[model samples]
Target: MISRMFSRFNISIGSVTHQIFKKPTSLSRSVIARKFCNEIARPENFATAGTMNDVHIKMMERIGLEPGYSPIPRSREHLIQYQPSSADLPPRSMADSFTSAVIPLSSSKSLQDLYVSYLGHVRFGRLMQDMDLFAVWVCHQHVNIPNLDKNIHLPYTFVTIMVDKIDFTDFSPKGTSDIRLSGHVSWVGKSSMEIVVWLEQEFEGTYKKITRALFLMAARNATNTGPAPVNQISPGNEHEQNILIGGEERKKRRIDHQKMSLLKVVPSNYEQSIMHDIFTRITRKDTIQLDKRVLPANGKWMADCSIMNTIPCFPEHRNAHNKVFGGFIMKIALENSWVCAYLHAKSRPKLETISDISFEKPVDVSSFLQMNAYVTYTEMNFMVVMVVADVLNPTGGRMTSNVLYYVWKCNESVPEVIPGSYHEMMWYLMGRRKLNYALGLTSGV
Candidate 1:
C-alpha cells in the first residue's frame, strides 16, 4: 500500500524538472533515486528512527522542502572560545538581519503543478509556510549577534510563537510574476523579536505588494532550554522607526490578548463588545429559523461534517530544534479544513486569510497527531472552518497542540452551516468574529 502511494512521487523524484534547488546538470537519475531511498530506509520502528513516510515527503515537497537538503553552515570551528557572562546587550542594526528571497511563482513548473490542486491558485497554505520559514530565518539571523562574553556568536534557536496583522491585499502571484519575500527584524525584546515579512510581486516594472505579516519568535538558549537574550535592534531612519513602533504596538496587543484568553470569565467590558452583541443576537429564538431545512443537514449533525484524520509526526518534518515545523502543521491543518469546507459548500474554496493560529504546545516527534476540521459558520459567499490539532498520548489522553482559524470564499450554491445545538451556536459566533477580524486586518485596523 505504501509503495502504491509513493509510485507517483517516485516518478516525479527522478524527473530532471523536479529540481528543488540548484544541482549539477551531470547529476544522474540514479543518484537522485538513491538519495530518496536512503532517506526512507532507516530503523523499522518510527519511534526509534522518526523516518518520514510517503505522506510527509509529498506534503513537504508541496511546500518546498527538498529531500536531503542541508543549509549552508554558519558557525566556524574554533572561531572563538565559549564563555558565560551576564553583560550588556549587543546592539545590531536592522540591516544586519534583513533577508530577501525571490522566486518565480509562475515560472517554476513543479510549483505550478503543485498548486494545480488548489483551485487554480497558488496554495495559500504553501505561501504561508514559506512566509513562516523565511521569517524564522530572519529571526535566527537577528539572534546570532556577537556574544559580549566571548568572541563567538551566540548560538540561539528560535521558534515562531505567534502570527498576526496579516494583510493579503492581492491574490497570490500565480502566473509568471516573480515574488520577492523580504523579512527584517523590526523590534526586539529581552528574549523575543518581532520579524515583519512582506511579499511583493514584480509587475511590469514596479513591485506591487501582495501580502504582509508579522511573526513573533522567542529565542532559546543552546545549552539550556530557556529563554535567551536577543540583540537589540536600532532603527536607522524614520521609516525604520515607524516599523519598529508598529512592532512594539503589536507586541503589546499580543500580551494583552494572551492575558485575556487566560481569564476564567469574560471581563465586564466584554459584554458590551461587538462579539458579545453578535453572539446574543444570533442565539435569540426569534432570529433563528426552526422549520426551514438547511440544505445538506439531513437532520443528522454527524452527516453534515467530515471525519477526523490522524497522522504521526516524524523527525524529517522538524525544525532545527527537533520540533515539528509550523509550516508542516499549517499545511495539514489547511488541507483538512479545506476538505470540510468543500464538502459542505459543494464548491471550490478559495483561501482568504489564516486569521489566527495558536501553538499551545510543541507536537512531540513520533506522537499520533489527529486533526479535526468542521465548518463552524457560513455567510453569503463565505465560510469559516475551525481546525484543531491534538496530540494523542499513550495513556489514551489527548492534548491540544494547535488551533487554526481559516476563512475562505465559496461558491454561491453552497448553503450556510446551520448550527444544530448551543455548542454549535457558540462556534458559529466565534466564526463571525474570526471573519470580522480578518476583514479588519485587511483594512489596517
Candidate 2:
C-alpha cells in the first residue's frame, strides 16, 4: 500500500539552487550588541512628535524600556562599526532592533471567527497568522532605511519562505484578554533572515509565554519581483549563536527534505523496510477488494467528516505588494482543518503541528477562494488534516493555488479514519509522513 501510494503520486527528486550563507566568525557580545544598536538605532527621537495623543504616545513606547524611554541606546559614541559586528542576540535582546505589538481580544465573536476551536481553545492557525505578521513587522524594522523623503519609507519587501518549530506548549484560553507579539531578526543570510516571534499573554503586569515560532522570510526587491539582499544580523550571545546554528541546520534540512521528496526510489524494492509487512499484507490478498475504498471498523469515512469553506480574497488581506496575503490564506486553511478535525473527533482537537503549507502562486484579492479540508489520516488519537485552496474562475473553472497539511493530536473521543481510494491513501501516507517529521520520528531540520 505504501509503495503503491508513492508510485501513484509520481514523485521525483530535483536539484535546488544552493547558496552559501556567511556568519560572523568572532566577537564579544557587548561589542557586537553595541555596534548593532548603533547601526540600526532610530535616527530621530520618538518624542519628536510633539504633543502626542494617547495612541501616539503608546506607539512611541518600547516594551522593555523605562516609561517614556525608547529603544535607541542612551548614546552611540561607544560604536566603532557602521554595521553589525560578529555576534548574535536573541529577538528581545536585540537592543533597539525589536518590534512589539499588542492585540486585545475583547470580542467573543471575532475571537471565535479567528482563534476559537471546536473544543473552545484558541486554534493554532490564529497564532500562525500573527507569527507571520509579526515576523514581517520585525523584518521591516530591521531593513527599512530612512528615506531622504521622510514621508516615503523604502522598506524591503518580504514573504515568509518557511516557518519551523512553532511550539504551542502553553494553550491560550478562548477568553484570554490581549496577547503581545514581539519579534526580531535572529539569523540573517544574504537574501533571507530568520525572524523569531513570541506570543504571550499579560497577567498582573507580567507576560507569560504562550507560543513561539521561527519564521524564515526572504527579502524581495523593492518592486517585490525576486530575492534581494538583506542586512546581516550579528549574533551577540551564546543563545543567539545557538539560534543561528539552528537556523542554518533548518535551511539545510528543508533543502534535503525537498530532495528526498523528489527522490525516485521505489518503495516496493525495499524488502527490509518498516512498511514492508503492511505493504505485503495488502498486496498479497487478491481476494480482498482494492478498487473500492475501505471504511474503518467503526464506519468512519471521508465524506462524513470533512469541511468546505468559501471566502473572498479581501483587500485587507493583501500584502505590502498588493497580492492576497499568505498569512490570510494560512488562517483560512487552519480554520477549515480545525472544523474537519472537530467533525471527526466530535470534540476539540489540539494542534500538534502545522506540517506544511505550499503556495503554488500568489492569489489576487479579486478572486473567490474555495477551501476544502478533510481528515486525511487517523490512527489511535493522531489525526492529519489536509486543506486544498483553489481559485474560482469566472469561466466556471478552478485553479489550484495552495495546499496545507496539519497534524493534530486528538483525545480518545476521536474515531479512526479509513482510506477509500488510491487518491485518499496517498493523502494518508503523506499525512503520516508529516506527523512523523513533526514528532521527530523521522528526520526533519
**Per-model TM-score on C-alpha atoms:** 0.69, 0.71
The lDDT per prediction is: 0.61, 0.60
Q: Which segments of model 2 are wrong by more than 4 Å?
A: 1-96, 106-124, 144-151, 174-176, 262-296, 302-305
Clash-forming residue pairs, model 1: none
Q: Tally clashes: model 1.
A: 0
Q: For all candidates, what are the clash counts?
A: 0, 9
Candidate 1: misplaced stretches above 4 Å? 1-88, 104-120, 147-154, 175-177, 202-206, 267-303, 411-414, 441-445
Question: Whole-model lDDT for model 1 versus the true structure?
Answer: 0.61
lDDT of 2 at 378: 71
Q: Write the per-residue lDDT of candidate 1 for residues 1-445, one digit (tens) a residue.
A: 3342233123232121111222234534333422332121111221110111232343333223355524432222232234222244567767667766666555677655754453355566666777787776676556543434443344455678877746566455654556677767778888888777777778779787777777778876643267777778777665565566666666665665566442333433432342343334334355455444333322224236654899988876776445678878888888888888878777777777777788889876668999999787665667788998999997899999998888878656356455565556556656765775665421111
Which candidate number maximizes TM-score? 2
